[model samples]
Target: MSVLLSACGDDGGKGNATNTPTTNNNNTTDDETSSGGSEGNTSTGGPGGTTTNPTSTTTPGDPTETTEGESTTDGSFITPPDGGGGAKECDQWTQDCPEGQKCMPYSGDGDNAWESLKCTPVMENAGQVGDPCTVEGSGVSGIDNCDKGNMCWDVTEGVGTCVALCVGSPDAPDCAQPMTSCLISNDGVLTLCLPSCDPLLQDCPGNNLCIPNPQNPDAFLCVLDASGEEGQEFDACEYINACDKGFTCANPEIAAECDPMAIGCCIAFCDMTEAGVCTGQNAECLAWYEMGQAPPGFENVGVCGIPQ
Candidate 1:
């Protein structure tokens, strides 16, 4: 293969500008590349006739020295790893891989080097969306509150600084939170509810109390407590007179909303539906409500009615 050389001033190598070869008086070539030094000069014959060897223009650490289509010791190459079909780009390891190849973690001298070893999905300490508490302390790579899946992208940049483009999963724990679009973690873990202090931050449906689960205080969660026994519920609109005003009465086991003045009165309860809405059950009248719909029920004592 032939290499091109041009004359150009060094810009402190800031832009990796190609260096040029300069000719001298003795019919010899002067190579300014790092590998080419001050002495070896030779003349060779070309197809036309006689030709002089330019100052031995071999560049040190030249990637071209390696054979074509081969990866460096650090798994990088002119091209990315492709299966026989040439379909998918071998990007990540913690997930499934193509038939002939295994999804090994990226190994490189740069930031991604360590990821090659840790190829399992986060399970135990995994966090979900709307969780305010962020990772803290030393020995932790990357910044806190990196959305939901953008954590790994930050790793590729500088362990702590966030980057604009990332190749891994959008749910990689580094992405910004309240993530509208993302797959579950490799282990299918997710954040369901957030702290209750701010209604906007609350992940549970309206009138439901989001509290720190006594079982796992570190994880803030949402649970319905109709008995008013959950130590003061907040933001719930009171529909039943039994409980204090301003708090929606909710059933512990089932998600049902009841009004104090309506039938079924304080006895009706609230539950969370699959679609993330608060629902009510246990009305003497078996009226139909959409599985994920949130609308007021009927009225009358013992009759299922929407919470006030």
Candidate 2:
């Protein structure tokens, strides 16, 4: 695991740059990806993703039939809300589209990562949340079998799981399922709610790392472990997910070992519950957030750092 949630405490972190969400910035839309893909294609830095979440879609086959080697879907089909058509722009959150059509986030500019929102037809027998689903075009194409409020995740060559969209508004987004954290990436184009996990256990499936959401350090999300160099403790890092597993980047002032010139550097996380056992030069297992601030199950979270 790269970070923790439930609240994960904090990174004492500052964004610089790194690929997130499957190393691609593909996490955003079930419709338009909401364009929450990976951070691989864009800007400076963020912890939101590159788990390649758009690793997100597939073209639909017969809704009621599964041929050999095909995955079966679960639950009743969900009908997407509608909006008018003809390339009319729409909002992913509001989902105000025409009958049978839904608002989806997609790469309208062709740069990928669901940079824009558009209207598309909902699949017949659209897959419900947590069901096996499919998508059309590319991951960010915003066309898929997932019902509104959900997207196909971890798509591999056009197959993936139907994951839920964040339930709340963008500024204070959250997940409906317990222990899930909302991940916002691609400059707010993507809004995904992913399961949270333990950093010590490194429990995330596949190659993903459990890291703090770059937008909200204490609330961690399962993001792609895009550590090209696999930075070690005290090694300079520019992004929250750059360090090796169990390590995260922090402000330089957090440790004397960190080079003063670097924007941030990798540091190990510690359990505040085991206070005396974790020590460092001018550093300690300090609470990652103000006491009583961490979400339940994360009260014990801490980081090895100098008291500021």
Candidate 3:
């Protein structure tokens, strides 16, 4: 099945500037037969809803590579908790662990690397729905927030909540909450149970807004709206739309020079012709590119950044 989520647009420029909103194509296979494996296809469109395909001139690199000039810090790295009050870190690739424990990587987020890899005791008693969880940090893999069957999903900034894994279908849902619905990720690889909300009614819990689910247009998730306390440049954000006006949530994996955190932080978009418009005293207006996915008009996008 194919699900499409509308990508947030870059609206920093004035009139006559191109407004490029992206489309996330969630391509999925039959849930019953194949393992859940999906990829994201981003389509770029210009103003007046005109679509344009840019020529591919450069081969995309591995998604895990840090951007140029960006340095990764090993701080906040999590080690395996020793039941006897000792700390031991395990290497996931080498499978170095005690006889009963296994070296595992975090699967809730899309990150598959071993930034915060750990050895976890094999247990069947994972956390249930509504349980608090730790958000996975960048380059870190392996999570102990949930039991073997459940997934720890980032519902909001710094808030990873326990959720069930299931094949997304309207006829039968795996969520325990009556109002919760199964939502697929942008890449269509993982299906997670998220609380349901209605945009028309505007009745979402917290300060969240009923935003359209990019994976499934027929569904919506309660996401934080860019209002009071919106993310500024260098502030962490859950989604691009969560940033204040004139800013875009830039992935640290793409920024390379910034600290590698779990969530992308806000960065100011800028006009290339304007001089000294960026907020930072040493920031520069550099071309911005979305990692892996190519949205239209973003081929020449620019954002303010500190010089490396």
lDDT of 1 by residue, 1-308 (tens): 01011011221111211111111110001100010111111111100111111122221111100000111111111101111111122343233444433222222223211112122233334333323223222101222333323222211111222212123342332223342212111011111122223211445544333321111111222322222232223212111111222222222111144222221122221232212232344322211222222123211101122322
> Would you list the C-alpha lDDT of every candidate in the order shown?
0.20, 0.47, 0.34
Runs in model 1 deviating more than 4 A are: 1-146, 149-283, 288-308
Query: Lowest summed-lDDT stretch of 10 residues in model 3?
Result: 61-70
Compare the candidates by lDDT and give the number of the best one: 2
TM-score per candidate, chains pooled: 0.17, 0.66, 0.37
lDDT of 3 by residue, 102-130 (tens): 55433232322122234666444556777
Could you give candidate 2's per-residue lDDT for residues 190-212 as a string of tens digits? 56677788765667777565655
Off by over 4 Å in 2: 1-88, 214-218, 275-281
Quote model 1's TM-score.
0.17
Compute the lDDT of residue 99 as modeled in candidate 3.
Answer: 70
